[model samples]
Target: MASSGQFAIVTGASTGIGLELARCCADEGFDLLIAADEPEIERAAASLRADGAKVEAVQADLSTSEGVEKLYAAAKGRPVDALLANAGRGLGHAFLDQDLADIRRLINTNVMGTVELIHKVGNQMRSRNAGRILITGSIAGFTPGSFQAVYNASKSFLNSFSFALREELKDTKITVTCLMPGATETDFFRRADMMDTKVGTEKKDDAGDVARQGFQAMMDGESDVVTGMKNKLQTTIANVMPAETLAKQHRKMAEPGTAKD
Candidate 1:
């Protein structure tokens, strides 16, 4: 049973910032439909339900159009109040050394599938002229990630796309807010095989705090947010720094075997 007719959808909600984002929605008394590629999504649903929110979990791979459709179908045409497109994968290595298949999947999951789902749900929101969208971009988008080339490129696409979409929909009640976070305490570094890199091993922001800030920004209809002072500074500098300089700076942080003791 839903505590409220209002509902929110969060992708990649099995863990990390995604799960925390779902929690934020639930805390706001919204029903939730959360998805992830892993079976752990069920556990995430259970946890939310324990807190009194009506929650549904769909274990769908969000890297393909078919998977995106599966999630969309689960909504059963309900007017979603909010859509948090947070599913994405990261890769860390020299661009040439990365496997082609991994690169393709990253692009598909981060870029293609996200836009596909947004297109479907966004049209629904536009029809009603009421809704919100929170895209999980990253500070990584602002920099040229040398060892993490493809992943950063994907974030960059999202950052640009979100702003453009927000401008296009400015006349509507629907709001599109991009959540650009810095590195956080998530499994992202481990999954990206970046444990040996300096950036991977460095201290990171808390996932819960990041998600809370993002959710609030979405509710407030803010155009975008960069979570921390350090990251804010990074973005400001990135705007002025030369591309080659940014790339080299990224290399120092992301290059393998660079982790400090």
Candidate 2:
């Protein structure tokens, strides 16, 4: 992709797809403002800087207004050319087996925090009427995640919300693109406590590849882009498959200990 000397903000950049997405932005010649809840975000920033990219990393808990404000403040009134709202949380196992606190945190980070940041930055994009927004949704949103209910639901919300937002901005230059990736090689499965499950243990797509696909789609202003061919076929089947059947299939992959079962 050709380089653009612009500004962008990518959240959840400490590791995984978020970090790769930030790299794509830098490669495209965009000055970056990246954030994550972990201190590793600073390290990610340093590495990007080593490559001659101008990056500002913020360690903020984006599940609250304060964190959202901190990120928005970092831009200091400069217009953002792109907003990669990629911060999200995941949880595995039965809903009943999970603590409500963890569940709440997951929901807040995935849904609330993401929406808050978008509402703030999206308005600025609107005023300028030229910006690209890439949201990291999941192919898990296509089905009912039996053991991973909340996380899937949050992604479904994002998938739906992206379409609505895109339509709302259809008359403008602002484009909202949802990047729906299936399982990818990332710390997400471990962080979600699903290492014992089949999907967690199975081979998955590369995070860098996924990020490149997403970034390209966003630059082209596509409505949505699912990362892999297998995932694309799966989602196609999901459209025709009954919800209960999809849920059952999801259970087989996401249920704890299913890898050995």
Candidate 3:
């Protein structure tokens, strides 16, 4: 059985869905370790603290090894009852037009950072014999993106990693969940400079609702949870459609000059 002091670490908890997830966990009376690259992390920490959650805020870039190491060090000696590996960003425009540094950061944060954090915390959870992990994957992973190519590919890797890791730890008490959401209202699009794109400005689902679904599914030990009916339908269509067709459909939404929506 887990103790009352058990901790839940949520990366990217400064805003958007990650912030909502942190609030959700705190509402359930769990201590929190919230990480973000922004100064807003302190504001989030303060809010959670005021709400009676014992919160620790760490402002570190999750796109680098040093940043991830900082978070791991902060979590040492604490029993991680739950972990939300939710830190991520998106990119827009032609892949060739993007700066090499930006591309590297996207890959590092979405792929390498997630993999390393999961590997470490996952082992600790297994050792403790009880834990739950919720990874943020995107609906874009199901199809090949044109302008947003690298971001989608990174999410595809995350989707695969979460599912495979879940199977590998099936005998243990630790639970792993992958959350797949599509076109949620978030700073992601704005940050990616993709607000003009269809996926960015089109009518979107709320981040809070999406986070709630994932949080509930994590508690239930579900392997994967797709939020919103439209998103579910999209996932279903992606499963049945040919890769070439899906990629073509995505180009209209993701390509810079196209505006099919």
User: Number of clashes in model 2?
Assistant: 0
Model 3 misplacement above 4 A: 1-3, 257-261
Candidate 1 global lDDT:
0.95
Per residue, candidate 2 scores C-alpha lDDT tens digits across 157-224 of 99999999999999999999999999999999999999999999999999999999999999999999
The TM-scores of all predictions, comma-separated, are: 0.98, 0.98, 0.96
Model 2 poorest 10 in a row by lDDT: 1-10
State the weakest 10-residue window (summed lDDT) of model 3: 252-261
Q: Please give the RMSD to the true structure for each candidate, in Å.
A: 1.1, 1.4, 2.2
Runs of candidate 2 exceeding 4 Å displacement: 1-3
Q: Residue-wise lDDT of candidate 1 within 140-208, one digit each (tens)?
A: 999899999999999999999999999999999999999999999999999999999999999999999
Q: Per-residue lDDT for 1-261 in model 3, tens only? A: 122676899999998999999988988878899999999999999988887888999999999889999998997668889999999988998899999999999999999998988888888888878999999998989988888999999999999999999999999898999999998888998899887777777888898999999999998999999899988899999999999899889888877645434
Candidate No. with top TM-score: 1
Q: How many steric overlaps does candidate 3 have? A: 0
Error of 2 at 136 (Å): 0.5
